[model samples]
Every structure is written in C-alpha cells, then in structure tokens.
Target: MKKLIHTLLAGSLLTTCLATTSAVNAMTVSPQNWWAGMQNSSLQIMLHETEIAKQQWYLESYPGVELKSITKTDNANYAFINLEISPNAKPGKLLFKNRAGDQFEYPLLTRDKQSAERQGFDSGDTIYLINPDRFANGDSSNDTVQGMAEAASPSERGGRHGGDIQGIINALPYLDELGVTQLWLTPPLENNMASYSYHGYAITDFYNIDPRMGSNELYHELSAKAKQHGIGLVMDLVLNHFGSEHEWMKDKPTTDWINFNGDFADGKHATSHARQTIQDPHASEFDKRQFSDGWFVSTMPDLNQRQPLLATYLIQNAIWWIEYADLSGIRVDTYSYSDKAFLADWTKAIMVEYPNFNIVGEEWTSNPAIASYWQAGKINNDGYTSSLPSVMDFSLQESLIQALNEDESWNTGWVKVYESLANDFLYPNPDNLLVFADNHDMSRVYTELKQDLAKTKMAMTMLLTTRGIAQMYYGTEVLLDNTGSNDHGDIRIDFPGGFAGQKTNAFTGQGLNSDQVDMQQTITTLLNFRKNSPAIAKGKLTHFSPKQGVYSYARISEQQTVLVFLNKNTTAKTWSLDYMREVLGNHKSATALFNKQKVKLTKPLTLPAMSALVLVIE
Candidate 1:
C-alpha cells in the first residue's frame, strides 16, 4: 500500500488518495476522533470522496480490533467502514489502506476517567437556555467569514449578530453567580444556510461547529471552562432535518437519504404538524407519513431515518458528540418528527452507552398524554417503547401562561395550572419532566405577563419551586421583553451588555431599571435557595385545589419541607391552612423565603395579592 498525502482543509482533515493509477482524489472522514472502551464496541466510520467506493479497503492488523465490513452506497462517493474494538482495546492509531496504495490514519483516543458515569442534570439543576447569536460576542473577528453565506447584521432581527462559543465562555461567571447549573444553547452546529441561520435549527454539518460561531476545539474548550464554573453543557441537536445547502443536497448519498426523494414539490410536501398522529389509535398511514416524512420547510430537507444507513449515521453522530465534547446532556429538536423506531434506537444507543446521562426531547404538545408517551417508563398502549429520559412540559408552559393571564374562574386561571399538574399521573416520573415558563421559540415570559414585575416573579417563583427539572430563558432574570412583535428575531433579542453600543449591561448591572433589578434579585434568590433545598431536589409534591384565587402546594422530603402559595387576587387575602393538614403535619411555624419572616402555619396565612410566597420548614 502507498502512503496518502494529508492536508488540512476547512477544519477537517482531507486525504489525497489514489483510487486508480490515473485518478487521485480527496476524502474526508467524520467524527474527527473516537474513544476506546465505549459501551458499544462497534464503530461505523463514513468516508466521503470522489468515487470512494471504487477502492477496496483493509485495516492494518491491530490487537483486539477488526474491520467487520465496508458497505458502499448507491452513490459512488460514499463508503461506510464498520469496525469492532474490543473492550480491552487501547488508545492508538489505526492505519487503513486501499488496494491502490492509498492510506489514511484513524485515531482511537483515550476516554475521560469515569466518562460513562457522568451525571446528567435533573430536578436539582436550573438550566439556562441561550441563543448564542443573541447572547454576546466575545470574538468579533469571526463575525464574517470568506465562505459563509451570511454576514453579521446586528440591526437585522433575522441576521447573524455574531454570538460565538467564546461569548458563552465569557459569561460563565455571570451564569454561575445566578445559580444556573446547566446551559442549553440552541444548536451550535454549522447551519451554513443563505438566510435566517442564526436560530441554528437548520443544521448543515453535524460534525463541525460553525466557523462564524466558533471551531470544534473552541466548543470543546467551552465544555471544559463551563465545567470549572460548576455548569454542565446541554447541546441542542436537530436529527429530523438538515439545512438544504448541505453537501448531501449537491451530491446524493443514496436514493433514500432524504425524504420525498429530496423534492419539496412546492410546499405540497410540507408537514401537517399534527403531532398527535403518532399515538392516535386509528391514525391512517397517510396521515402519519404526512406528519413524519414531510419537510419542515423548503430550506430544511427532512432526513430519511427509516433508511438503515442513515439511522446508524445519526445514532453514531449523537454518540460521537457526547464522547467528543464531554457533554452532560442532549436536547433533541423536533424529536417526534423523526422515525419513531429510529428515535427509539437513537435514544437507546446513547442511554446504553451512558446510563447516567440525560436527554430531553422537544414534543411541543399541550397534551400531557402525548408528551408523556415519549418518556422512558411509559407503558404505551401501542406497544411502543422510548428510551428518552425527559420530555419538555409544553402543557404546563401553556397552562401557566393562561393561569397568569386569565381572570379567576372555576375552570380557568389557577385551575388551569392545578389541572395541568394533576395530569402528572400520566408520566412515570413527573420530576424528570423539563418545566419552563418560556424558551427560545416563544414570547418572553415578562412580555407574556404584560411586563408586570409582580406577575413575572410569581411565574418564575412557581416554576423554580415546581416538581420538575427547571429551565430558564437567557434574559428572564433582567426582564428582556419583545412586547409588540412575536417575531423570532424579536423573541431572541440581543443581550444588553453582551454586545457593544448597548446602554444596559446585564452582566455588570449597569443602567438597569428598578424592575430589572428587582426581577434579577428575585430570580437569584429563588435559584440560590433551590440549590440546597432537598425538598426541591427529590421531594414528593402535594398540592391543593385553587380556591379564592390562591393556589398552594408543598414539597415534602425527609430532611426538609417547602410550602408555596400563589395568590392571583388583586388584594391580600387570609388563606386557610385547614386543607393542608396532611402535608403540614406538626409544622407549627416556618420561615418565609421572600420576606425572611417566621409565620405560624397553624394560623390563617396572609397571602399578598399577585405574589408567590415560599415557606421552608425544618
């Protein structure tokens, strides 16, 4: 075999190989590197080049390692090499060569100590979600690149504002001080689209970070730096689709790689967005296909996860990221849109590899039944099983908004929230659900509450103390609002101090108004208090029905008990503790979290109107 000359090309290593005596072409391999001793010994490495399949390949003899097979696709440019590394395999370079004397090196690196035993964020953590482009710009030089499709336009709502991984790393101290235990940024992978790519849903390169955002090394650096601040990183991943501008669009990998044979057919192939069809007993095949196989938009080509090769590719891609980036968790975007079986396999593979790791799927449904069906322990009537550890609580998000915005009524207001939580019986593990007031996709909670600071505090206080893993949007602490417009650009507005020319800087508390400071203080207090609360972490929740515009609940644990009262009334009211006798057992007195005053639990508690009161009992 002849040695191949290697050259660095566009952040990825490309090898110039001889496929034939007269032909020399470049090939790129994915998953930059892999680690030994992974739970699964099997590895499927993909090679992309001109007529890559034409060459016969073999792996150099290595102890405890064997090349199982090489699968070629319908397209001449792609080849999938399957290899198995034994449990005792050590870190070393594996040299692979073809019959035409072309060779390349693949590295099997060492795993971090106790990597598989890494703990995922749970009820004990407060996840802060950030839109990197809107967060801060630590590096302004990479704002525009020679090959990137879009330029940085700070004024344009949809244009890239140049928020990179360094920006997130720079704000780690602020996040840690605010008691944020985990950070979930929108997909940091390369979008590389012509427009509106700042949101990061349209993924172009799964293996690489966007150069305009940062490099792969920088992303790894982010995980390391964030860990030092006691923060875990949760990567947002898009598996159902890819940006249309991806190289796969230019050169077909296989006939079945993309759904609908890579044709949108003028919006006729668009998804119905009816997520219910997945669990509907009588749902038709056509409806299921229309919802699952249809494209999200013309710019994003839906992937054909039903294809076995593609299924393996996505599953391995997710695992590669977890091992490569030292990720704490994964938040899958458009989770249900992918093939159900593939999702099961994808999630199961990761869970099997890292039993302690967590993955939350975005179901985006207001129905508890639909959302709970995707959770791990659900005994689905359809005989379907899911390995997903967590599901987003869209039902609570919608109900909480309504509960705060609507007037007091028997079936509305606080009752909406009460009924929503009552549906917790549907989930196998209610505490594992991801609960949040607002996220990157919707209107800010402050704006939803009509910029009412009191209501905003109540909403956040209730959310933080609720019985689930909590996630907060980037600027909720300082009241970032998109009052008049519901546009995505407006919803994901720039962080004040994160960029230049901003009068206010949230990081330093510069030029902040009274309400902003108040909200900030309130969030900091709740988050900090929640950090050490045993009741909030693993306690049993007991709540009372809404009465007289007040909703009350208690988190009971062996070490601590917490009482929360949310009053929606416009005036203070005396709340009876008679109904909470079972939960308040022998707790005569407790200290209020907000006011730091001792209150007798036996007496009728005075609940301030439109406020949340949290009491801790030792």
Candidate 2:
C-alpha cells in the first residue's frame, strides 16, 4: 500500500506538471550531452524549466567538472550554468537535485581519438552537393513519422518524398564511384513547421535530427560510413534565424532574445533587405540596425546576437555539432547577415580549436570585390579583419556561364574567364574558394547553355580544372534542368533513382537516354583523372589572352603540365603550338587526356569545332 501510494502521487504530479508547463520546458537542457577531452575547458550549459531559477535546485558534486556559477536570465524559466571542465575529465554523467528529491542526469561523452587534428575538405576534393530530402528513398517505413505534421506526399513536387539519411547512406557507393570526395548536404536539423518543411532552412531543434529523416544515432552512422568510403562530410548551417516553432520561442530566454520584438503594433514588421549597406562605409545606423535586427520572415524569428549570452549560446551550438558529428567542413548560409563581430569571433573560436578545418561562407553576389572582403588575409581600409579562409566564387560562376553562351568577339567570348581570374588578386586565398557552374539556387548549367552539349562540356571542363574547389549538384550528372520554371522545388527535384518505381534510375543507368549516359561518362572520366592529376589539383594556373578564336590555359606543376584549348568557332580550327612555347617548351611529344593518345606536338594540333581538348605536355 505504501509503494502504491507513492506511484499514484508520482503519476498525478507528472500530469499536473504537463498541464502547467509545455512538454519541452518541464525538464530538459540544450545540448543534451557534451564530449570530454575537448581542448577548450570552459563549457556553458543552458537549462529550461518552469520558473526553475526561482525554485530550489542544487548541483551535486561530480568528478572532472567544476560548477563555476549558475547564471540566471530575466526570464525565470531559463538558467545558464557555466562549468569548468578539467582536461582529464572522464566520460560520465553529472547529477542535479530538485526540491522534491528528484535527480536529473546529463551525460558527458568522450571525444573520438585525435579528433582535434582531423583534416578538412580542401581544393583537391570534389564536393557532391545533395539535398537529402530529395536524394533517395532507401526505407519506406520512415516516410511519415508519427509525431510530425507533414505527411509524405510523393505526388506533390514540394512535399516530403521520404528521402532520409538512409537514402544518402545507400548512395555512398555511387558517389564514391563517381570520384566525389566530399558530400555537402543542406541542413539536416529538425524543422517542425506545419507546411513547407522540406527545405529545412528553418530549424526548430538544434540538438536532434528530424525523426522523419532519422535519429541522431543514424546521422552518426551515415558520417561513419561516408568516412569509410574516403569521403568527408560538409554540413550546411544557418545561424541567422530559426523556425518560430523553436522551443525557446514560447518563452524566450529574455525579452530581447529575438530582434524586432514588440517593435510594431501588428507584430508584422518587414524583413530587412540587408543589402549593399553592409559593405558601405557611410551607411546610417538605421540601415545597419535594420539589416542585423530584422527577422527573416514572420515565421522565422531572427536571433539577437547583441545579447552576450545569446551570442555565446550560438557559438557553443556550432562547436557542439562539429564535435558531435565529426564534421569536416561547415558552409554557413546567409553569412554576411549575422553580426559582424560575432561572426569574426565564431570563426576564430572554431579555427583555434581545429587549425586544419575549412569553412566556406555563402555570399551570393557576382562581384568579386564584395566577396573577397570577408576573406581572412585581405587588407581592408576599413580596418576590419575576418577569419574566414574561403568563400564561394559567384563571380566565376557567372563569368564562365556567360562566357560560354556568348559569341567570340573582341570584348566577349573567353575574355570573361581571363578577366575573372585577373581579379584573383582581390582574394587572400582564391584557391580555397568554391567554384561551381550551377547550384540549387540557380538554373542548371545545361539549361543556361540552351541545351547545347558542346557548350556544356566546355563549362564543365573549366569548372573541374579551375583554381578553386569544385562542387557538383546531385542531378547535374544526368543533366537536371528546369527549363520552364525556376522554382526551387523544380530545381531540387527528386533524383531519378532516388525514389522507388521511377522509370529512370541514374545510379543503375536504367531508362536513361544516350545524352545523359554520355554526360555522366564525361564527368566520371574527368573527375577520376583529376583525382590523380597533381597538376590540376594544386598547380599554378597560367593563361593567355583570349585571341584568334581560341581560349587556352595551362595548369603547370613541377611534375607535369596540362594544356586546355576551347574552340569558339563553328568550323574546325588548327591551334598554333608556337604561341604556347614558353609553357609547352620544346616538348615534342604529348598525350591527349580525353582519349589517352600519344600525339606529336611538333606542329599545329588539329582542334574540333566547339570542342574542348586537354593535352598532357610531355
């Protein structure tokens, strides 16, 4: 009877607790667990409960971790506890006690061996960009999770089509066979919004992966399998705003947790343009405030980094993910919209922890001058210094595509590529930049070239052999295009083999047309050759001015040199080997890279019309 009464009271008290406080806030903490043996000894853990700060909760003594202080915010529901962990802290759980004598356990895990010294993605790696939700469906049972709002609607283009982490794991062999060394997946964090959660930009949970996709353990499994295939994982992170349904939004850590709160009568303020004023020297304070303080959308609340605690929380969240997932690289979305000072500190902290790591920021602008300003070593007159080592080369993507589609002329044709490279002096480390022909946000390169195969090949050749890191979208191998519409849903369509019952399976080459097969072959050959070609990987690039209907360039290293020529005319032309004598030298013999034929370079080489020829000068 005594045990029965205790159990009945416990159940009754739990029911009352749920009625009073929402399920998420009753008893939990952000970053549910942390790893031991981190180089950084200081760790801040945030706790959430119903007026927990006012209630009595004392920390129990634990080994290897010292309770520094319990910091409370203006809101009584939240508390920030700072802990100083010793370098030798063992992987164990720390206990805390409530007034009712209830104990809460927070687990501390051990870091992987030599985790701090892991190498990141570099120029030598060709990145395969995948939208996980649209990639493949490996498991049918996980199509619609129980608690999730959105159901899998395969008929709708934008609906969730049952692609999960298992789908990506299933396609690893195909990716590896294609010579892809890195996988860059868009944000996989939970977005519990009722509608349009397929894109995953709006995050509702930081600590857990979406159940519809998979569990946290499954993500770790995917990472481990990817490493076995000699592939690195790059995570796309968005730090600007989060979904309104985030746990903290119900009762913010403080009144100022979100920006633009209580600023308008209708609470429907406009999203900030956040445009050129960020780079302007004479911009007004209003512009800066509006840019940094405004929300992304009504449903996505912008976080205020001006609050010191919020700033630290965001930084710690990033570090946690890196350690948790063993990530190789991070691609920050809306990189320039966040607080400039916070971004500098965030990058510095992560780099200090892992010196070999690489982070590329997404600044979708076509101006090289603007893009280079955020690079690490650029000397800006404004006296601003950035720790970001790499940025996406949107200018090169625009120039290369525009150059390929236009006619050869004095100011047109291949001059774009030459001039684009001429501006390389603007960036501190241009080699670390990510160069691509087209990504999810833009039209496919094939579409941009008006479905011309020769033009497509020329652009692909430049992208693969260019100076910076190269990235290929998921369906680019099979000529994924949105000729009639530019909607993101259309652009990020389901991969041919990703879904079941599809007529064409790009992976197995089933139901594929000749053009798709040939394109895939072309990319596979180029990528495999590049994997072993040191000259193309880290070589010094030298190119002559686009002249006489030929745009030619050479990648030279100590061991070998590769000469690439693109003909811009409708008729076949003979390219003169005489002008390239300095780089080519008196090398009388050469081998064609495409066909692997030993050709004598003693005289002018015959070139096909509107074709690309790569020759290894011997």
Candidate 3:
C-alpha cells in the first residue's frame, strides 16, 4: 500500500510539471507581429496561431480599452482583431488571451498628447540625414539573409554594409555635440529585394522594420533615446511605390491596386511638361495619364493612391508611425510621383491629426517658382492647394553649386546664392524651406566642391546662418567622400566606427584628416551658436548685392540682431554696411559668433576670401 501511494505521488508531480511546460510553450510570440509596434487608438492585430484555431482570441485591457471586434479567418488558424483604445488608456502592457487560457503581453507606448494647433519649428536646429545601411553597422550578424542574393561587403558599392538603428542611437552624443537637433533616417522598413537594397527607397512591408537594421521594437527604443537627448525623429516615408517582391503584389486585392497591374513600364521623365499638365491648356490625355500612372522602376511597382482603400491604408500607416514612434516630422520620398488629389488628401488628413507636426516634401526642382508651388500658403492661380508645410530648397542647392564652381563673372559670381535668396519673396514662407547642399540622391557636397576645405566651410557657415531650416547630410561634417561616382551606392558610404571591427572611429574623432577635423569643428561651432540665438530663428532677413564678390545679409529682431557676410573673391573684401542698415538697426558694436571677437561695425566689415562670418550685435 505504501509503494502504491509513492507511485501515485510521483505521477501527480510529473503531471504538474508537464502542464506548466505546455502552458509556457503555448504563450508564444508571433514572429511577424508588426502591429505590436503600433501605439495608436485604431489597431488591427493580425495573428497566426494554428493551436488556437478552435479557441476564440480576444484582447483584454484595463477599463477604457475598447475592443472593436474579433475576426477569425476561414483557415481557422489566423485572427484579425481590431481595437480602438481610449485616449486615456494607460500606457502600459496590453494582454492578449485565448479561450484555452493561453496569454501573451505586448507594450502600449505613450501617444503624442500635444494638440494639432502648435505647428512651428525653429530655424536654429540642424537636420542630419542618414542612409541606415551605410551609416554604421551596429549589428553585423543580420547583414546577410538566407534568401537574399546580395552578400555583405564594404568594398562592393551595391552590397549591404549592415548599418543598423543601434549604431545611430549609440552616436547620439556625437551628433548632439555636433549641434544636430533632428535625425532623419532613410526608411527602415523591410525591403526584400534581390539586389541594391542599401538605399532603402523600395519598401516590401510598410509595417515591418527591416530585420537587418534590427526589429521594429529597436526603432521605438531609438526614438525614445533620441527624445531624451532633445533630438527630434524625422522618419523617411515612401508612399509612391513598393518592391516588386512585396507579398501583396503576388495576389493583389484588386485589379487597380497598382498603376499598371501586370503590365510594367518605366517612369516618364519628371519634366515640367509631365507635371504642369492634367489641367494644361493643351495637353494630350495620353501624356497626362502616363505622367500620373507610370512605374518608378521595374522593381518598384507604383502604388495606386487614387484608389480609396489604398489611399486610406497609406495615410493610416503614416499616422501609425508618428503616434507609435512619437515622430516629430516626416520626409516624404518621391512626393510628386503619387496622385495629386490623393497627395493633397494625405497631407490634409495628417495635418488634421497632428497640426503641430511638420512634413517636408521633396519636389526636386531647380526652379524656386516650381518648388514654392508645393509649399503651404502658395496662392496658385490654377486654384490648386497643397498641405505640405515645407519643401526642399533645390533652387538654393543649384545656386550654391554654381557659386562654388563658377568664376567671379559679372552675371554669375558669389551673387548667384545671394540672388537665389532674393527670390525668397516667391515662397509663401521661405524660412520653412529645407535647405541642403547634398542629399542621398546627390553627390557628396565635399566631392562636388572638389574637396576644397575652405569652400566646404563657407557652405556650412551659410547653411547654418541662413534664413531657412538647415538639413546636413550625414558624414558631411567629417568630409566623408564618394569621389569617383554619383551613383546612389557611392553616395552612401559606411560610417566609420559603426561596426564592431572597424579600426577607425568617427564617434571619438579618431583617424580623421586635418581638413575633416576643421570642418567638423566649424559646423559644431556655428550650429551651437545658432542653438541659443533667438534672433536667427525668428529675425527678419535683409540682403545686399555682390560688391567685389562679396554678399551680405542681416537678421534683426527686437531683442537681438545678426549679420552674415560671404566673401568669395580671391582677396579679402570690405563689405559696406550701408545697405544692411535697414535691418542692423543702428548697431555699432558687433561680436563674432565663431571666434568671439568684438568689432566696431561703424566702419566697413572686413571678410576674408572664400569665407563667411556671423556677427551678433550686442
């Protein structure tokens, strides 16, 4: 009898252990739980669980959590659960359960609680744009995937370099010290393309973060850390197209889901003829249709934003990221490629949702008139309206390139840039323009200037002290080079010290040339100076002509005033203050922001050749 009791006791213990193990195993996380990264009210959670087929899956939360509905798939293994969370729902863990008593937990991050009315960004901040894969490889283990055809190699221009979000997060201190207030990363979404995915313009899954860069959760962590350092996050959004290998492309929901369903063609040239039509006085319908409905590349299938369902999905996806990652702004890629009406609607809805947030569109035109038409507040005679708050200052880019490359001719001297600014009257809000010399699509500014250290410094001085918002491409300050080619791959070189085995470290300022060091120091000095100056942010700008290849401007406000002089001549020139008197406002003593030297501006200010200066009046 005692032996029998011992057997029964041992059996009971074994049973309990098996039950606990099974319960723990049942609580598994979905590998493709993309919705888990979201942080908004309307959330659609897609689940794949074969074991829970017979059981009902429901979301449970504390009071104020509103469950929309539970939808089960025909396969009985998938669930599409929708939930509308209350604004007051506590930011914490959300538990999901099944009828069999299995449970899993996911986090609900803090939503942006600020109202939509607060919409204005100060000009003192500098935006740093980075191409993730080439920036730094914080995690190299995920560089090459099993199915991906491209191999990981730094020497190969088109191969993946494995830069991840963690690399940038780790370099926050370096960026902060460099006077960067905003970080704009290229789209980190999944790109399952076969080759040349380093640029990240073609997205395969809008909701899933690329595993090569780390999981979606890592991106959220990066945003949180960035906010702690007072750095705003600017997500690069691509609403125009998706990779050809996208899962949805295999079985499109509708025939009109893509621009040329099943039939592919190259995109039309982005010329005035293509864009100005649709309402042109004499435009062929064929031209207009081709302009609006053409593929960007054979690999990038153009999305049909004109379709209401697709439009809503794209808009909602953008909002989800903003609320999820607490993004400060969005840099919409290929903004002109999408449907015009749909683009207008997308911008309007986003503004309605977060009026305070900023959206900068890339129009990519060298004409100020063409670029200004896309910015908000432009009164077009054609009765068209755009909700975009800001646009890339491509006109300024052209002027800067010209000013650096051309000689001091009477018609095209350093005054090219000065003249470009003079045309700011065409823009509804010139200060809202995103000014940059080079970006991901363009050659490196240093390479374009032929590695002229002085010219690069002058460009930086003007970009930081100018009247518009400044965006500096990553590695610009360090004189990062892409010398021989203008291809996208060449432009995005890997950041130093981002990977584990790198010998040189950019973060700690090691292995840098003297010119690079000087450039880095110059940018840091100028940006830090602008950071505390309210005059540069909201002051009125006034400019004067090129005398002896010199151009000058002054920003004045009630509390503070600043003057900037650009001298491009071979010899030093004395810039007359007579024309800038209107904005200088009777200031006699001027202080140099970079060198901290005091000067009496009662006489003409002497500016060195190929140099720029920022003078603050006390």
lDDT by candidate, in order shown: 0.91, 0.82, 0.75
Candidate 1: clashing residue pairs, number: 1
Model 3: what TM-score? 0.84
Question: Using alpha carbons, what is the TM-score of model 1?
Answer: 0.98
Which pairs of residues collide in candidate 2? Answer: none
Candidate No. with top TM-score: 1
lDDT of 1 by residue, 315-395 (tens): 888988888789999999999999999999999999999999999999999999999999999999999999999999999
224-306: candidate 2 lDDT, tens digit per residue: 99999988888888877888888768889988888886343244554566556677889998888777777767777888777
> Residues 104-144, candidate 3, lDDT per residue (tens digit)?
55555553446334343447678899998988776778787
When 1 and 2 are scored with TM-score, the better candidate is 1
Location of the lowest summed lDDT over 10 successive residues in candidate 1? 11-20
Note the residue pairs that clash in candidate 1.
2-101
